[model samples]
Target: MSLKQESPDESLKSQIYTFCRQIANSRPIISVCLCDGSMRAFFGGTKALLEFLLIIKGFKPRLMNYVRFFDDRPAIFYAVDRWVFEKDVDVGFLGEAFAVHLIFPYTPLVNAGYLRAKEVKLKKRLILELLENLVLTFPELSREIRIKPEYFVYESMLNRARLFPPMYNTLSHFFQNEVCEQNFNRVMEGYLIALKELEKEGLVECENGFYKISKSFIENFKSRKTLFTNLFRSAQKALFMSLLGAFPKVLGVLSERADILLKFQFFEKG
Candidate 1:
């Protein structure tokens, strides 16, 4: 069944319940994935499942609470056995429902700037946790996803922007770094050009003077690939050129490091 933003009706709940029970009885690993902003069943080997579990290690109890108690909140809930997933404990939802909660922000914090200082501080903490989970889950699967370097830069800008104090006076701070600080105008010019390119591509948009990532970007991120796969080869090339032209030295060093890492992986396999 296709998952959507609609509230869970009684029939949908029953189907999910049955599906969970059947899978728990037979499968050794059960995972739920958010796809196109909806929850659906996901299957993976033991290692992938374990890696995903590590990313979400601490959020299980809260997620189980969300599942056990029905709320008017528009969410899809699924139940799976903790014993089946973890092998030792007969406890919670085995991190099933939490994936939905953690991955998708129910409401995008677009006006984060308007929030009070204390409120912004609290939001930053939560955003950081979400960011950590997201980073941990993706690196191992990045190869399979074929995430291009330019998209990585685009995603980094959005994430880094989220970490900044929303009240900061200028968006240029989003591009600030040791490299940018040293070659300020050059790096800033390149990043701004790249940012505008990303905006043109619709992966990000300017909202309240902040860059708000698109739902399509989030979906691609959730899947660990597949955002602009068939669509943006030319745009991706343009983005790479923008970065390469702006930071040739830095990109050169990065390329060398990547080559070394790739060689090491090959050595291990060989």
Candidate 2:
């Protein structure tokens, strides 16, 4: 059945099964010993990692939680067992195998900012960066069209803005290193000011908290394709740099599983 015809639970199950089957078919397996506790930990860690990855890909937190509980755990275990039985590898090795084969490769596309993640911090810099990237990637955003700040903010938050203080709180919690209440307010203020500055520069028109891009900017941007290309390249550079900073921490986490460490080394070489 098509995804639209299925219940959310069924759809989730299908997605998990598909992912497992792909892994089962593709990755070469290796043997490794694991105690029951270690196996459980690997599964738990993999689940958490997937949840984080999904969150970064703009999935709703509530939906991810539901899928994790009802579908992901079972599917993951099934994949591990299938790999173990088929390849004569210990079950422990499959977690790292799945992560290296599936998760790492998928991350870059998600990090590309094509779909804004839910719970993504709507800091002024990120919003501006996104706008800059959007203008670079899609000429349409540069056109003269009215857009409400509220609408922009809502979309920037990936439609999760409706959760209000709670949503803000969640973001604060997750991004504790980068965001706090004071910083959040400051960033918001700066975002508003940036809009005002764009209005002042005649790049946009702001009236009564609503704004519209200027026709002149659109015409200018159209002529300056090279500038847009540079902006796009810069956005990509920034994304990779951001990921690099977090890579060590992620590597440390995966290193706990020797099989994952070896798989990661193999993937890195290729």
Task: Identify the leading candidate in terms of lDDT.
Answer: 2
* Candidate 2 structure quality by residue, lDDT tens digits, 1-270: 111111224554455444433333443322111111122223334432232222111212211111122222321121233222222112112212222111111212123342112112223333444454456667765564456664444354432223222233223332355323333342244356556666677776776666766777667655654675554544543443243223433443554454463443311111
For residues 145-243, what per-residue lDDT tens digits would candidate 1 score against the true structure?
432223333453344333332212123422346323333332233334555566677665655545555556555666754335422522442343333
lDDT computed for candidate 1: 0.31
Q: Over all chains combined, what TM-score does candidate 2 have?
A: 0.33
Clashing pairs in 2: none
Model 1 — which ten-residue stretch has the worst lDDT?
A: 43-52
Off-target runs (Cα >4 Å) in candidate 2 are 1-144, 150-184, 226-235, 247-270
Q: Give the CA lDDT, 0 to 100, for residue 148 in model 2.
A: 68
Q: RMSD (Cα, Å) of candidate 2?
A: 18.6
Cα deviation of 56 in candidate 2 (Å)? Answer: 31
Clashes of 2: 0
